[model samples]
Target: MKRTLTTFIATLALIALGAGARPAGAAGVTNAVAAAGTTNIVASSDGKFTPSTIVMHVGETTTLHLTSSGGVHGLVSNRLHIPLTRIQPGKAVNVAVTPSKAGTYVLPCAIFCGLNHANMKLTVIVKQ
Candidate 1:
């Protein structure tokens, strides 16, 4: 009886741990975007942008395909002058960016996304 109880408790613990764990999709990603014409970025509920970094070439127009989950989110880059309005949840918004010069810029979430809003920064690197 004692051995059976111990085994049952161990099994329960394992199940509990597994249930609490989140899949890879929940966490932000690196190199998540493929191709140069358009890149897809998914804003997660945890206030993170998938494919945190965006790389492109100067003079090459790149369109950012943005989506949000859980709530509304907005993306904007002051330096790049990429105008992005409100992005509804589960809806996609596109913003075209053409950098004449090569530099690194940060695109931040314009709308409030929660406590971690400050962390929701997208790195944009333009190569010559």
Candidate 2:
């Protein structure tokens, strides 16, 4: 009876250890996308960026979270030197940017999505 109890305790300990051993990226799996501080931008199949204007303060750092609603898209900003981030349907992309001075920056979709792709413009306003 004592041997059985010891074996049961050892099994429980092994189970506990295994439960604590999580693989990389397992924690906060639901938070794989942008965090709370980043600005969210949604790219739609209709060739538009929702909330086309992003406001930020100069000398402040922030991230832009880009996601697609209906189809694949990308975010491009020549002034910010941001490379195109492929935003697949249901996936999110993040871009970190900091404006040194107060000004207006234009961000657009680098990929040809649809008819209104040329009109897909995102404005970034930095203020003092």
Candidate 3:
């Protein structure tokens, strides 16, 4: 029974992974408009950032493709003062951020993920 349960859970996770964004007919946008140098961020229930840290030049734009594998989570940057809160499950939210100064910015999770929420952190480095 335990093995059966594990197999079921693995199947469920696969289903969630398949259900990323809505169909194009539902989202209305036929094509995704991502600007140049925009990093694609993929977040999961592992409390980790796919790229973890990124390097960008001053005034460089990047779009984050925030995705949830199972439950809901959010992206909140304390150093950059940007927050996207209350994200839903099986959803993908996109945001565009540009660095203006040469320094390091800390990015954190806004919504409640789990006990190790504090460790769900990342850094974005900007250079000249």
Candidate 4:
């Protein structure tokens, strides 16, 4: 009887340790999660998202600052993903996006900027 009790106790401890050792996200998004509005993403000198890409876990919101050194750009997404708002050249536009799904969403340029107008894109990394 004592031997059986000892074995049971050891098994429980092993199980507990294994569960604690596991990560939060099944996909392994272990980095610091950037909560909503934690940081603002800005467009690079070439009128592109500086970091260009963003990583976020499920159930989090974030703010993006799309700025252009020259020319006017708007946040254009499936729902006005262009610049957050209409800002003059050299100005920054703040846009908030809440990704309910785990996938890549594009932030296109709302305005007709010509030539490379279709190149504006933002990658939202959602951890499922």
- In order, candidate lDDTs are 0.74, 0.73, 0.64, 0.56
What candidate 2 gets wrong by more than 4 Å, as runs, is 1-36
Task: State the lDDT at 111 in candidate 3.
Answer: 76
Ranking by TM-score: 1, 2, 3, 4
Show the lowest summed lDDT stretch of 10 residues, model 1: 22-31
Candidate 4 Cα misplacement greater than 4 A, ranges? 1-36, 44-47, 79-84
Tell me which of candidates 2 and 4 scores higher on lDDT.
2
Model 4, 17-43: lDDT tens digits are 876654223113213344546544444
TM-score quality measure for candidate 3: 0.64
lDDT of 1 at 68: 72
Local error of candidate 2 at 78, Å?
3.3
TM-score for candidate 2: 0.67
Off by over 4 Å in 1: 1-36
lDDT of 1 at 110: 84
Pick by lDDT: which candidate is best? 1
Q: Compare the candidates by TM-score and give the number of the best one.
A: 1
* lDDT tens readout by residue for model 3, 5-124: 999999998887666445323233312443465555555577766567877777767766666544567777645546665545446677767767789877776777886667777678
lDDT order, best first, reads: 1, 2, 3, 4
